[model samples]
Target chain A: MSFLEVRDLSVRLKGGGPLLRNVSLTVAAGEVRGLVGESGAGKSMIGKAILGILPRSVEISSGAIVLDGTDLLTLPPAMRRQRVGATCALIPQDPLTALNPSRRIGPQITDRLVDILGWKRAEAEARARALLHEVQIADPDRVLRQYPHELSGGMRQRILIASAFAAEPRLIVADEPTTALDVTVQKQILKLIAGLQARHGTALLFVTHDLGVVSKVCQSLSVLYSGKVVEDTDVARFFAGPAHPYSAALLAATPKYTDPTAGLNPVPEAVIAAVRAEVENG
Target chain B: MTLVRTLLLRLMTTAVTLFGVAVIVFFVIRVVPGNPVAMMLPPGATAEDVARLTALYGLDKSIPQQFVIWGAGVLHGDFGTSITLRQPVLALVLGRLPATLELSVLALVMAVLMGGAAALTGTRLRETRVEGGIDVANGMALSVPDFLWGLVLILVFGVLLPVFQISGRVTPSLHLPFVTNFYLVESLVRLRFDLTRDLLAHMFLPAFALAIPLAAIIGQLLKQSLKETMHLDYVTLARTQGYSEARVIWREALPNAILPTLTLVGVQFTFLIGGTVIIERLFSYEGLGNMAIDAVINRDLPLIQGIVILFAVIFTGVNLVVDLTYAALNPRLRHG
Candidate 1:
């Protein structure tokens, strides 16, 4: 069995129709799997559902999220809560908003260690400093004492990365972690995340809209279109050539640096309609 | 350095506000169609006596002159004398200030505690039948005015139940130490638990009556803000960090949600002071509000002007404190 398995997942709005349909995917131990899609493709929703943090209005109509042989959906809420951060963690997008503005960096980073793992205050502080250093943050002591608003956006994102890794979680769900960052900072943060994930031998479910990011960081990729996975294949195979029509359209739509004069190509209307019909019929 | 600059600027603003309040109060009380001398004199008093008394209180002078004289006197802590009470207006206001302060503080505390509890409970039960009930109850509370609540409380607790005294800060017979003249504190200082209990018994109805509407307003604001704050990214991040639901709600969401509520609390504090007039009258509790009402009725110009200026100062002071609190709670404001 894979380390994390999302089998036949379906999510629906409270009063509205389905938001995510029968989506299935898997991640082997220490492997980085990417979920690539446009906005409203239910990529973030899947990440939230796996972490059991979906908004109140959204419900998993049918699905089972299995982590380490345990069905997360079947566990009691308290047990699931305890499992979060210890067994699975998340590096959220929009780092500027992800950290609590009212809180200082150190306590926020060490909260899981102190609150969930019940570590000593001094020990947690030490580990927090070490985590910050591991994320390549200089002057960890000053960073810890400062509030979220006091730090730059990249610094805040780095701190979030450190916090996500503080518990040495078995799985990390990174949902567009570098989307809000500048180009230079984005590359550094992505490299840091990839390096840390590899060093810890941790599984990662990377969700992003940028196919370029997926090509660089993800080993295997799942191309999602309109709430459905149109293609699931190795990253190398996906980059070389796509198997599914929607996947080919997505690659075609992505802007290539090699062809500077080639203005972006919009996905054809017929392709989107076909993808939507496939999801509806299925 | 920024803190000092901010403090200095606030102090200058407060000074200007007080000066403006003094001028407005002095002129507005004079504009009202009532003569302090006419009210002071008995039925047999002569016109010359009225003139002399009017001149004595500086009412005979022009409005600007009267303002200047009153302003100068106020700067020296002299608010002239009350024509009806035949005491210094400052003395009369000071004597009653403690009672009003005590009542306002107690009412404010009650409002905060009650509102905070309601917000927590309502937010927890949001999207349920119970939340609907809480909303309806809050709506009803907010709709009823403070004085009406005071009358209802008097009818129930005072008349029907007879569980508490109908009026006054303490029983006339129970004279605890007069350390601060605040019955509760005086009782405590004197170590008289009996008097303390009596004071609380008398204070309950009035404070509760003043608190109900304010609590409803605060509770509704807090509930709405908390619901929104819970959906914020940081709150979700807290949950994913393995913090329990309680921690997410209180530690993560409450801090952000409570900022707006703090401003409301400051506003409601001024309401408490204003509401105390009717509340004190209903309970026959002698506080600044009751004194102001008497000053208005008796046409005591000095007393009325003095009370109005005092209230204005209080309102401005409360707002200043609220701004300072905002700075303390928000680091962005602190640095800016």
Candidate 2:
């Protein structure tokens, strides 16, 4: 079994049909796993389930999210939160709103460390300052006093990344972490995440609809469609030669900067047809 | 320059509008029939006495002359003698003002605390049937007028329990707690805790009546704002960041949700003034509402005008305070 293993995980929304259907995944120790899917394909849902942060409407009908030999689904919410902070963390999609707007950045970062990790305020604050510096934020002390709204989009994203890194979790979930940033900022954030994950040897579940994002950091990739994993492969195999038609289409759809003369590739008819059939069935 | 310009403009507009309304209300009062001097006179007085009374009361003057004299006196800080009290109107108002102020302030404090507590509970249980029931109860309580609620409260707390006095100002023997012994520097001041309870008991009818509508409106506002705040990206991130439900809703959600309610509080404060009239009459509690009604009935134009001006000033002051609070709660409005 992998270090963190999910088996037969399913989520059904209230008054709605299955959101995830028997989806399973594994993240070996210190490896980056990519989850690629369309907007409603339950990529984020999988991340939420792993962290035990599912919405009130959704129920884990049948699943076992085993992290380092413990069944996460069986733990109480408070215990689960402790586990999440010490063992795993989530980098949410939009940095612009990922932080509490009413609080200064430094206190926001230190609060979690003091409560969840039992780090004293001074130690936690020092850690926060160091994390900010690591994330390349200029004038870490100044940023500490400033509210979320005071920072630029790129700066906010960096701060969020530093927050996720602050606890030194064993596993981190970056769910479209840089999707809301500009292209240049997106590259910087991805590089930052990649570098941090490498240095700390923490497992990463990087969820994105864009295959290009996964290609940079993921050691392994899983392609999902209609709440099912359609393909699972190593990064080199997945990109160099994709097995699933959906995977191939996703890769083809992704724009390439090196080949500027190449026109955009239209989406594959097979994937489109499959998606249409799924939509029509519902 | 910028702040002063805006403040000047706002003051000018408010003053002009208040002046127009005051003048119209003044004329409307004058047009109504019963004479102040007549109300004052004994039944079998002579025609010469009535004439002398009219001249003495300044009722014999032309409308413009009367207005000029009244307005000039107001400018010079003189609110003429009251027809009923036969003392300077300002002195009478000032004397009675503290009583009304004490009642209004106490009732408002109770209303804020009760309405806030109820709103917190309601929003916390919004998904449950109990929350729905509480919401309906709030709406029903609010829909019934303050006088009716006051009567119901009086029946329950006053007649049935017999714990509280039915009608009166603070018991003359009762001294307020905490502030009585300022001379004792080292020790904490002695307090009559029972007196505090007694005061609150007396406040029950008026405060509950006032708080019902405020709570209903606040509950509705709170639920809407909480729902919106919960949907915001920050809240979602907080959840993923592992904040407990209470922390997420209270610390993260409630502060942002309170922005709209601050505006509502100002408008409701004005409503409270209007509501006091029926409540005071129903309970036979002496307050500004009762005084204003008496002045209107006796057709004491100067007293009515003075009371009206007092109310306008209070209403404007409440609005100014609310605006200042709005700037504090919402950063966008601060500089703007």
By lDDT, who's the top model here? 1
What DockQ would candidate 1 receive versus the native complex? Answer: 0.72
Runs in model 1 with CA error above 4 Å? A263-265, B55-58
lDDT of 2 at B221: 78
The worst-scoring run of ten residues by lDDT in candidate 2 chain B lies at: B180-189
Clashes of 2: 0
Every model's DockQ: 0.72, 0.50
Q: Is the docking of candidate 2 incorrect, acceptable, medium or high quality?
A: medium
For residue B83, what is the lDDT in candidate 1?
A: 80
Write candidate 2's Cα lDDT for B1-336 as tens digits.
Answer: 555776788789788877876777667777878888888889998999999999987879987788778878888989787788667877666655555565666667776776677667776676898778877877886788777778788898888987766675445576554432221111122455565565555555776676677767777777778877887777776676677877778878888888888799889888887787667666566666777888888878777887787778778878877877777676555445
Clashing pairs in 1: none
lDDT for each residue of candidate 1 in A109-137, tens digit (9 for 90 to 100): 88778888989999999989998999998
- Candidate 2: TM-score? 0.92
What TM-score does candidate 1 reach?
0.96
Question: Whole-model lDDT for model 1 versus the true structure?
Answer: 0.89
